[model samples]
Target: MRIVWFRQDLRCQDHPALSEAAQKGEVLPLYILNDTHPGKWVMGEASRLWLHHSLKALSDSFNGHLAFYKGDPLNILPQLIKETGAEGVYWNRCYEPWAITRDKKLKEHLKKEGLDVQSFNGSLLWEPWETTKGDGTPYKVFTPFYKTSCLKGEPPRTPLPKPTLTCAPLPPSSLTLNAIDLLPKKPWGKEVFSGWEPGEAGAEKRWEIFLKEGLKGYKVGRDLPAQAHVSRLSPHLHFGEISPHQLWADVSKIEEGHDTNHFLSELGWREFSHNLLYHFPSLPEKNLQEKFDRFQWKKDPKLLKAWQTGHTGYPFVDAGMRELYATGYMHNRMRMVVGSFLVKNLLLHWHEGEAWFWDCLFDADLANNSASWQWIGGCGADAAPYFRIFNPITQGEKFDPQGDYTRKYVPELAKLSDKYLFRPWEAPEEILEQAGIVLGKDYPLPIVDLKASREEALAAFERIKEK
Candidate 1:
């Protein structure tokens, strides 16, 4: 018998692992929820909730033969192999540093046990090392990275199909969704649970909807936090509920010329993230260049609290934070804007913001979240320059002209005019009173002046270059 060990690849559709397992022998589909690396890096509460639904959905697809375990997979898989007499193991690839290490150890252990082990690329459309610069080094900046990756010949024209036979019809196994402690016991999960429906079917439905209606205007409308123009498939893609190939396939079919081409290149950005993670294993944690280590950062607890609680008094930043808290997602543009406000405006450590997102976002991907945080902090590959501080008020006006997104999330300031939405501190005292907002009580005033903060950040950044 062969074992199909499911990691992030939660779906059966386009899963090369299942096909390979079936080819080997009766597949014992498995998923191991190893918290052994406690603090090693686990999914947030929101992500755990999504995983529960996604796994339940995958099990539903199968006739309940899939097995799940809670502890170390290295320990559990060996026991399972001995019990089921499995001939081999097959699974998909993951580019996260921890995952790469885990897979390597598992493969080596399994190989020593005299069993066959195999893996395939499913999480990303292209491997990180594939589209390097001519010197064979990974692309550090995004524009050139995107260009090189996009210019490379397209992904395989045809995607792999679901395995014809997941396993030679096996007797029911003793695994259910509740057996894992992934679900929350209390009432707080209600909001997050309500926001998502996990599994391949839901992912496909989301992609289909995006491809049909959202892709055409994705370039123009993706920046607007108020609309659903951007594909809301991050969690699915992150969890491997849907393969990157499946997403790429749908976009590639769009006959709308430049729009279609642009969409495909955006998909390449996701690949670019994975590639960077693979090559720079310390990525997301370490700066791509080392001089950033000397950059001065504040450990201001009050500022950190304000930033985390959406009380920064920067309307757009607060709105994005609240939106992230309410829904387990945020628009890509706001991610940069809010990240800049925290790192650049507040002068807090990038890791602090990365940790907050780690706790909040349902789609808290290791590579994307870490890379994005570092990028915004002006400390990592293709990062926004340190001098380029986001004027939160102007960014809000430009990206959310109508301030609809902010109003929806920050209802206390909803009645405030669009002009005052971005900068409540600058509003007249009467206007603030009429809006029932005290600079510090009803809503906090800007914690720091933007102009002063920008200059402080830029001057401090100069030290790094001087060294």
Candidate 2:
């Protein structure tokens, strides 16, 4: 019997490991909720909720043959091996640093124990080390990295039809979902559960909708927070509930025409991020550019709290933060705006903001999250130059011209006209009074002087550059 240890690659369809394991022998499907790295920020609550739903969905599809385990895999798998007398183990790869270390040790130990072990590239369209410059070094900048990846075309095809028979008798599993403790005791999951449906089927449906309807308008409307033109598939993608190769294949079916290149490039950006993470394992914590270490960053708890709670008083910033709090996902444009507000307006460490996003975002991926935060803070590979500080009000006016999304999330400014919604502080005293808007009380006053803050942040960047 073979053990198919499911990690990030959660689904069976288009899963190379699942296909290979099934072909070799009877397979025992397993998902271990190992929390050994709990203090290392194991995974966010929103992601755990999504995983629960996705696992439930997979269980349903496999007729409850899927088994759940908890604690360290190296310890648990050996015990299972003895119990089932399984001959070998198979799994897809995870690129996170901890996962990489864990897999290395596990594979070596299993090999010594005389068990067959194998892994496949299931998450990304290309492995991180696969594409490099002439010197065989990974591409540091996204544009060139994207160009090279595009030239490589899609990943080699490895489609697996759904299994026709049950994989072993589930090994008389001693494990249960409650043992994993993935669910919270409180009601925090209520909102997340109601909003997001997690599972392979849900992910497939989302992909189909995106390719058929959203991809065409993605370039133009992806920036509009009010519209659902974006895929909103990040959580699924992040958790390995879906694969980039599968998504690339499906999207490729659309001929190379209007917006097709735009959509594919965005997916390519995701691929590049994974590639970055694979090459630089410290991506979640280290600044890609070492010079950024000299830059002075604020450690203001009050400002961070205000930013976290969405009371920053800057309407655009507040709206974006509140949108993230209310929903685990934020629009891509709003993500940029909110990140700029945190790093530039508050002058806090980009790492600080990155840590917070790591806690809150359902799609808090190591590559995209870390790379994007550094990009906004002007300390990443191929980053926006340090001088480009986003004007919150102007950003709101440009991306959210209608203020419809702001009205929905930041209801304190609801009664105010869209014209002043982005900059409510500019409204006359009488107008503010009529809207029940006590600027400092109901909503926050702008936390920092936008122009002054921008200059200060720029000066700080200059200091780092000089160093």
Candidate 3:
């Protein structure tokens, strides 16, 4: 018998471990829940909620035969082995530092017990170690790394087909889905997030939707938050509800063009993040460029709270934060805008923004979240130039030209014209009164002066560069 262990790779299709297990023998489908396993990398409220729904969907796929156990995998896997008399265990790999450490130790212990243990690349398009510079070192910048990876390849191997399974009966200690309690005691997620369907089927639905609606205009429209031109697939990809290989294959069906290549490069960024994390386990905590350590960052609780609650009074920044609060997701362009606002305009550390997003984002991926925040804060490898500060007012006016995205999330500013919509503080009192708005009462005054803050941020950044 074979035990098919599920971790972040939750779905069944094109899953190397599950597919291989089915081909070999009777499969004991398993998901072990140990919040202690990943240490401080434990699931946040949003991820916890998604996991609950995902497990239910996975169990339903197994026809209610999946074993859901709550314990350390060391203790639980042994018990499961004894229960089923399984000769081998198989699973897809996880790339997080904690997951890497845990998987290695677990694999060693299991193999010592004389049971066959196997793991496969069920998550990434290429193994993180596979892509490297010609000198056999990791690439620190993105463009050369992206171009080099493209040139080095036989394109991604075709995704494996779903394998037929011979199921084993569940063990007596198997826990019910409710016992996991990935859902919150509070009702915030269920109430706010009804738009997503969390399962393999749901992943397929989103894949189809993106292809039909988003493929043609993604190059131009992806940056426009008001348009439905981007795929909301990050959470599913994070949960392993969908595979990059599958997404790649489908997009490849499109006639090769700028739009298709742009979308593929975004996927490459996901790959690049894992590449960064694998090589530098300190990714979530330490800045990649050590010079950033000297960068002056403030610890004003008011600024942090203002940014988190979406009341910074910058329309685009606030809209992104509010959207994250109201619906657990933010548009990518807005993510960069808000990230720059917190780190640059507010002079708060990038870690503060990173931590907030870690808690609030439904698709809060460790590698992408940390790497992207550092990139925007101008402290990471392949980071933006320090001089290229994002002007949030102008960003809002440009991308969300008609104020549609702003009005949706920041409805208090709905009556303001596009001219003053993004920078409401600059509006005259007559216009404010006409629009039935009051600064700091109905909405908020800009928490920091844009021009003043920009100059301060630039000077502070220069000091760090000199150091």
Candidate 4:
């Protein structure tokens, strides 16, 4: 019997390791929750909640034969092997630094014991090592990386079909899904995850809906937070409920155009982030551009709390944070806006934003979270310029012109007109009263003057530039 280990790749369809194992002989599906090795990068509360439902769906697909264990894989895998007499182990690759180190050691140890141990690339379209520059160094910029290397290099392998499975009986020692304790004890857990369907079936259905309704006007409409142009597939992709290969192959069949090309490029960006993390293992902790190490960052607990609780006084920024808290998700445009406000306007460290997102976002990914925060901080490869601060007022007016997205999250400002929705402090007292709103009480006054904060952030950037 072969042991097919499930990690981020949760779905049975198009699973390389699972298909290969199933083709060989009876397969024992195993999931090990290794919290200790990941340290600070362990799966956050939102991710755990999603996993709880996802695991239940997967186990149901296997007819309750799936096995679950919680501990270091080094100890648990060997014990399972000895007990089940499994001759081989197979798993898909994970790109995290800790996971890479752990898997390498496990594979070598397993091989030494005369067992077949193999890992397949089931996540990324192009492996990080496969898409390097002619000099064999990783690409630091994304445009050339995608256009010159990735697009021009060997295409992603065709997705595998699910193999017919002959299952081994569940090991008696396998723990129940609830025993893993992935769900929170609080009432908010159910409320936050109410609309999300976290499973393989849900993922497939979402993709189908996106293909029909969302993909047509995706390029321009994707920028509008209120619009339903986006696929909302990040959490599914993060959990590997759907494969990039499947998405790419299916989309490639469509008539090539701006919408299709732009959508594909977004996937390319996901690849770019992973490439950065794989090449620079310290990506989550350090600045890629060394000069940013000397950048002065502020520490203000009150301001941080205001930002976190969606009381930041910048409606656009507050709206994004509120959406994230309410739904465990935020629009991509809003992610940049809120990120810029924290790292630039507030002069807080990017790590603060990264940590908050790690805890709050359902789709939070280590590589993307780290890289995107660094981009906002103007400290990573091909990062946004430090001087380019996103004006919350203009951003809101531009993207959410009708106030649909802002009002949905920051509903206290619902009665306010579009003219003052993004900047209520500038509204006349009569106008505020007409809307049944008081600036400081009903919504909030701008916490910091945008002009002053922009200048301060620019001056701070200059200090590091001079150094």
**Which candidate number has the best TM-score?**
4
Best by lDDT: 4
- My TM-score estimates for the predictions, one after another, are 0.95, 0.96, 0.98, 0.99
Q: Could you give candidate 2's per-residue lDDT for residues 66-133 as a string of tens digits?
A: 88888899799999999999999999998887888889999999999999999988887777777777
- The clash numbers for all candidates, in the given order, read 1, 0, 0, 0
Better of 3 and 4 by TM-score: 4
Scored by lDDT, model 2 comes in at 0.82
Cα lDDT of model 3 by residue, 1-467, tens digit: 89999998889889999988898889999998888764466778888888888889999999998999887898889888988899999999999998898889999999999999999998899888888887778888988878887546658879888788988998888889998777887877866667898888998999899898887899999999999888999999999999999999988888999999999999999999989999988989899989888888999999899999999988899999999988888999999999889988999999898888887888989999988988998888899976688999899988999999999999999999888999888899999999999999999888999889989999998998887
TM-score of 2: 0.96
lDDT of 4 by residue, 1-467 (tens): 99999999999889999999987899999999888885698888888888889999999999999999999999999999999999999999999999999999999999999999999999999999998999999998999999987788888888888789989998988999988778866665678876688889989999999999999999999999999999999999999999999999989999999999999999999999999999999999999999989988999998899999899899999999999989989999999999999988899999999999998888889999999999988999899988899999999999999999999998888999999999988889999999898878888777788999999999988998897
Please give the distance, in angstroms, between residue 251's alpha carbon in candidate 2 and its true position after superposition: 1.5
lDDT of 1 by residue, 5-103 (tens): 888889988898887777765787788887776344677777887888888888878877778778887777788787777878899887777777888
RMSD, one per candidate, in order: 2.1, 1.6, 1.1, 0.8
Q: Positional deviation of 11 in candidate 1, in angstroms? A: 0.6
Worst 10 residues of 1 by lDDT: 166-175
